[model samples]
Target: MKRGYTAKELSGKTGMPSTVRGVKARAARENWPGQRRSHSKAIEYSLDALPTETQIAIITAQSQSRSDFSDNKQCFPAKGKSPPFAATTLNDDQRLTMGARLSFVLEIERMTAEMTQKKAIATIVALSKEHRLDLFLHDRLVVANDRSTPTSTLSERTLKRWISTYREHGEVGLAPGRRRKNLTMPLWSTDFLRCYQRPTKPSVEASYMEFCEKYTSDQPSIHQVRRFLDKLSPEARNIGRHTAQQLKALQPFRRRTTKDLMPCDVFTADGHKFDAEIINPRTGKPYRPEATTVIDVATRKVVGISIGESESSIAVIDALRNAVQHGMFALLYVDNGSGFVNDTVREIVERLGGTLTHALPYNSQARGLIERAHKTIWVNAAKKLTSYIGADMDRQAGAKAFRISRKQIRENGGTTLIPSFETFMAGIEYEIETYNNAPHRGLTKVRDPITGKRRHLSPNEAWARAISTGWQAIIAPSDVLNDVMRPQVIRPTRRGEISWAGNKYFLDNLRDFHGADVRISYDLRDASKVWVRNLSGELIGEAHLDGNASPYMPKSMVEQAYRKREHGQIRRTLEKLRMLSDKNNHMSIVEHSSAPILDAARLAEAKRVAKALIDSEPTPFTLPPDPIAKYQLWQKLNADICNSLPLTKDEALWHSSYQTNMEFAAMRRMFEHIES
Candidate 1:
């Protein structure tokens, strides 16, 4: 055989690293057994001249022969180092004969080069047409009819087996094995067999096993049966993780379809558990509150929700409001929780634009969309929580222990608890936003028939559409109470002061009726603000709860007393000043100065009256020559310009043009001067 060419020769031909294995595969597949050259002018290399693994394999096979003997005596010593015969006894003729034989073999090899080259050329054409000659190492043959389904998960060993199977039998050999028969076991009807069989589903051997003793009077040995089962096909005897996977793969495909529900035509709202803490209403403490949430059926987006300590109708109402704020819905699908069935809640739903419906009484899957979103929000919030070390030291420390473990998920990426509610809410918002925009896997990239987008319209967007369709109805704040809220009557306390449950409230306008009767109506859900009305149903005022009576009073009482105190203080101060002035100045001040000292009290009153008069009809009013004079004395004074107060040039002009009170005109000119 010819010695193979070096790595450089292969590089010159194929520009690929020369490997003995590659050479062998080429020699075997291309039928290039020895040094050979065929279309010499072509780009192809002479395989016979190239080094190959087959040559190396042949050499390795003849290793024992090389180790056993050598014609040259000096080359290797005998087992016994000193030979008994003289070294010269070895003849040149015998060596020459051996050399001639080797030469003859080499000459024969050289002569067959053309024939081998021709044969190799023939083989190459045939192989190229019939077989791809595709060879792979430790790798897999992943086959899938659909590209969307992953084909990369195939294992190396499995692939090698598949390749071998394919080589022997072609495409038919690559078929997945049939379902295992032994794994099916056997089923026999017996007296107890009926007990294990479900009302629905198959009656399997395992299900009937319990009755074996009673019906057969003896149970078959499971081990023996298993051995018998092992005699079946390889698939039948297979055990462990792979068998389970195969069983699942064998199952017929099932499809889940969503109904083409209208926007707000149906809604799903429910509360789900979250490993989170919010203020507990019953205890007035923090605990993991149920996250009440609702979703729009058409958009498949969260519409309304509330995070609170309880899942009462109040919470449901809050979530409903959230959904309602965007638009009205026709039907509300909810879990069969006590809160949903409550009369108060039903009334609220009916009063609004929606009617309540229960999700499959006991099965939660009916409302899977919203329930799933609740879980998503919970998980997303928890994930965000892990990184949030809150400002509250105590909560921060507590949250470290509350961290979510990703291992618990059937899938990956669970959220951990964070200390800050604000941060948690922000994360929730981001998640919802992303979820709404993301293209659903089932929808592919096809445009929605309704909105012409891969994603369904978001709640707000869908609501906008509904509004265009004349489905939007405004539920005023007052109507909201009767529509979706529980009402509570807040009657005035015995003191004619209303008590908003535990908090006190008063009507500033009803000061005289402080000890009389009044009634107020407010949503029982939130006791913070109430509507004050008389015995009749007319709304008179709005008042907030009084929590503290500091500053020696409630807001209403304090404001009242402050006004009275202010007025009295001003009256007394002005009276004192006016009395001093009355005694010191002209005795003609007798009328009102004697009436009161007339400090800032009387001056402010007079100013206010004058301002009102000027604002209303100012034309008819006539001022005295000197407005400061006593009224009786002024009545007798002349209406002549001589008796009137003196005016500046501008004032004189204004007085002449407009009907004027000389004193008042002087006041206007004075004001104008001050402004300038």
Candidate 2:
């Protein structure tokens, strides 16, 4: 019935364009037709350009203006407020709308006492154009309903339905979102979802492509598949994307409640590799050491820590010892890691009168406290070093620092870039101290006396509180701890000594056990001595590394071996150089010079030696041989000259011998003169 109203009148009813300028702007934005009033500069605007919900609000205001809200008491007798429904089922806007609808039904019912329900509604609509209703109900009820819906508005049929819904089901029934109904997943959606629910977590479009691979007629389109997936619960949609163990993260999980726990009640342990590198004591190579840590669950204190080349059995045992020294725990909770599940760790737990419990495999979330502690403590500590090689570390920078450390170790036998063993241990200690003293969010808040503000308790504060409350730690006897923590291994007793860990440890008692298996427990820190026990657990006496092994320290032997090879190489190189120098000296002098070099002593000695050599080899002087032999030789030579038949063998031999004989010197000289 109302065709036009002033901007203020419209805003009062419609709950939009609340200010004068807002009305003008809304009119301009929507191209609303308007006319300037002759009485004032204000404008009167038609409802056609406004949203349907706004139009309905202005009409509803007219209905309320016709009669007092008290006028509705006869048809709906004044009663105490009905019980409040479970309003949580509806969102804020939905809840406001349900209230507005119920109010409208009550107002309509009052008007019904005088006339037909439809005519009563019509009469109120006519009066609202001339008059405004009470500001309170109009603003709270009418405007709230107007603002709730976006373009849609209430109608007589909708009002009638809400009246019935409210009477039967209370406020929750009026909110469409609160209504529950069956949502049957389309059968064909299974095929599309099958492709989508792959481990690769392919996109809807990619999944559609794969779904079309089978070429079935009932296949859903990509958009349809997306719509179906939108209806699927997150867990169902992601079932294939993550393993079952991982899926628990998406589901509800109980926080490991540490509220009731006391200090030393439960100790949770985990291992982390230091991000930065450290020098290995055995070899100078840079490496990341596993920092096995123990944390008191209740106080969140870092009670113990052990760093090693890996989270080995020894490392775990040592970490337990370190933790027990701080406070003996009733239970040791750790993951199913090899280092945690081994017999040595179990033995140590037994000695301390504690239970060893392991978390389920792949469920690290249960040990969230210690795992988080590793990040807060060890991770932060490692980043302080220059050689940090964490994943988030700057790639080029970390690599550069690592190269520097490695190069130093190779050429200088040590490096400052990587932390030294002592420095590393000290840093870990400082970090743990800082961690224990720092405030933790997991702990309950306590008032800070200094600042006069509530703050979370630091681990140290928490531990102290527990201690003061009469909670005490059970300390293991020193001798018992020492015996239990020692690592035991069965090694064959070789020769008259026990050989273990590359060191031959000798014991007088062990000689009788030679060629037999003996259980030996040795301190990792001190390899100098080992305790040998029989297989039956009887003491077999202590053995020392120096006994019958070698006179030198074992480490010194390694150093000596290294130096020995190095010095030998130097000696061989020097020998080669000397040989080369001797030959080179002579050849160089002779080849580079042509001048003759002589000494007077050299020539005189040469002459003296030559004279002695000539005297010693003097010419032979002897009497002549028999004249008959000489004559015979001459006759034979004369006959040989005349005939090739030659002289007889004896005469030929005699003549040859007589000619060569120095004893026939006279005849030889005569023959020589005659031949000449």
Candidate 3:
């Protein structure tokens, strides 16, 4: 940056005169290319014009000077104060001023080695103007000097003042008053703040309108208000503009660290509805299944997971119960879902000597880890399935797949693409296992044992690492776990059975407690059985749906309704066949099975044998299911007209005759009303 050096600075260089006047005399005698200094008689000689040996010495000295300037860390503090870098007992701004000036002193001292302070100051001003200082490149010097203007150059007057102050107070004298105090706060600062800092975050123009309305007499101009408001600290300016909850995203939050936590020190659980459709085990229909997952927050390892029809408190517990089988967590943090905030989860957490902490209501951000896990594990896997119905899937292709699946089911053809629940679950299990074994980004990084490349620890590896420490998890006893995991609800035992989730559970012993209000608790899965408890927490007995019922009987009203729908569908199909057979209803479908005419003698012998067999062995007979019952089934299934099974020929004639009688017509209308 330096074009040249003063006579005194150049004098001590190798092969140059030792005295300032000697160097000046030599410069004049050699006809050196030099320029006169501003406000001084001394001359600055050009380095290129100087002798080659002198030039090399000067350049080498300059290089060392600048290096030392950057490395200088000495702080000249006030009397009786110990020297410390930044932790000294000085005011914060005072330390920064000292630090900046100490660095400045180093550069100035090197320049003033054999020269006066004035000469050194002139050199610094020249170098800074040419953008020569390392600090000048990035505005470090300007920022230290507290300059906010567009210009990068420092003025001579400012340089003079800094030198004078340093002479008087040593290093501490460099701590000047900050320039921020120049801008003045308006008297209506409070009112302006109130108007501008609103939750709606109205623009300055809109807020100015409100301010004008509030203070009609002495309101400042919009520009004036904006200038003063710009001077306000960011924290103050943003206070009311963002609600506490809204500010959380922008605010700095303390992280809950996992380094001090063991494998099961904390756990979080959530349910995610899989994006893919799988065969609904019961109905054989395409449906999305919800996966309830429990994860060890410390290791980011999934300890338990269960995929079911829908998300429920039962699902939450079932996942947690699986988690406890490995190790009980010390704490539980989850969103404020009904499944998590219930007394059941609370009781279980307490039983494990831990605490259940629900996040703020409606705060989805609280489930961040689990939600991300769902994307990495479940969602990515769902995208691989043919039955996937995720939003991102191609619309035409997804619709085609959906239609194909349903068509196959409707036609009684086995599905070709949509996976059965069991197969889909097996795929899900593989995904989970892979997730656990694969490296997780949140885990601590380590050198790969085989490759020697850095990689994050896998969930399983992290878990094992935590186990290697002295920490150990408190395992829950099986009996205690079984007792606590069963979430209890009060239900009345009715007619030797208890109804739950639209399913009836019966046991012979339950009949004694009929019509009694009993506490019922059961596993989320296996709804076929429920444990009956008295109000006092006494275990009464376990009731099962299979009790006293036919092996194939519908155990629930849901199944009963399904059966009714099935029969109605069959009737409609039969009616369509009957129409195609014969409109007169003379040709019965059973007639196709009748034996053809045999030879006369053989037919007579067969008839005689059949008669004897029928006499000897009385056979069970069942009336044909109403094949003709569907004549009116389709028309009036949901119609406003009267609903009835098809009437036989003789019955139709009787019905017509009865309709003529006034009393019969009135009665018939009553029946029709009931049917409708």
Q: Specify the highest-TM-score model's number.
A: 2
Residue ranges of candidate 2 with Cα displaced over 4 Å: 1-88, 109-119, 128-183, 489-676
Per-residue CA lDDT of model 1 for 192-283, tens digit only, reads 33544344433335644555545654555656444544554544333231334444444444444544555667778888766555323344
Q: On residues 332-379, what C-alpha lDDT tens digit does candidate 3 reach at each position?
A: 888876677777667667867888887776555666788899999999
Clashes of each: 15, 1, 0
Question: What is the lDDT of every predicted structure here?
Answer: 0.50, 0.72, 0.71
Worst 10 residues of 3 by lDDT: 622-631
* Local lDDT at 256 for model 3: 55
Per-residue error (Å), model 1, residue 499: 7.9
Alpha-carbon RMSD to native, per candidate: 26.5, 30.5, 19.3
**Tens digits of per-residue lDDT for model 2 on 283-328?**
6577889988989898998887777788788888877777888778
lDDT of 2: 0.72
Q: Rank the candidates by lDDT, best first.
A: 2, 3, 1
User: Candidate 1: deviation at residue 125, Å?
Assistant: 32
Q: How far off is residue 279 in model 3, in Å?
A: 12
**Candidate 3 residue pairs in clash (backbone atoms < 3 Å):** none
lDDT value for model 3: 0.71
Model 2 quality (TM-score): 0.60
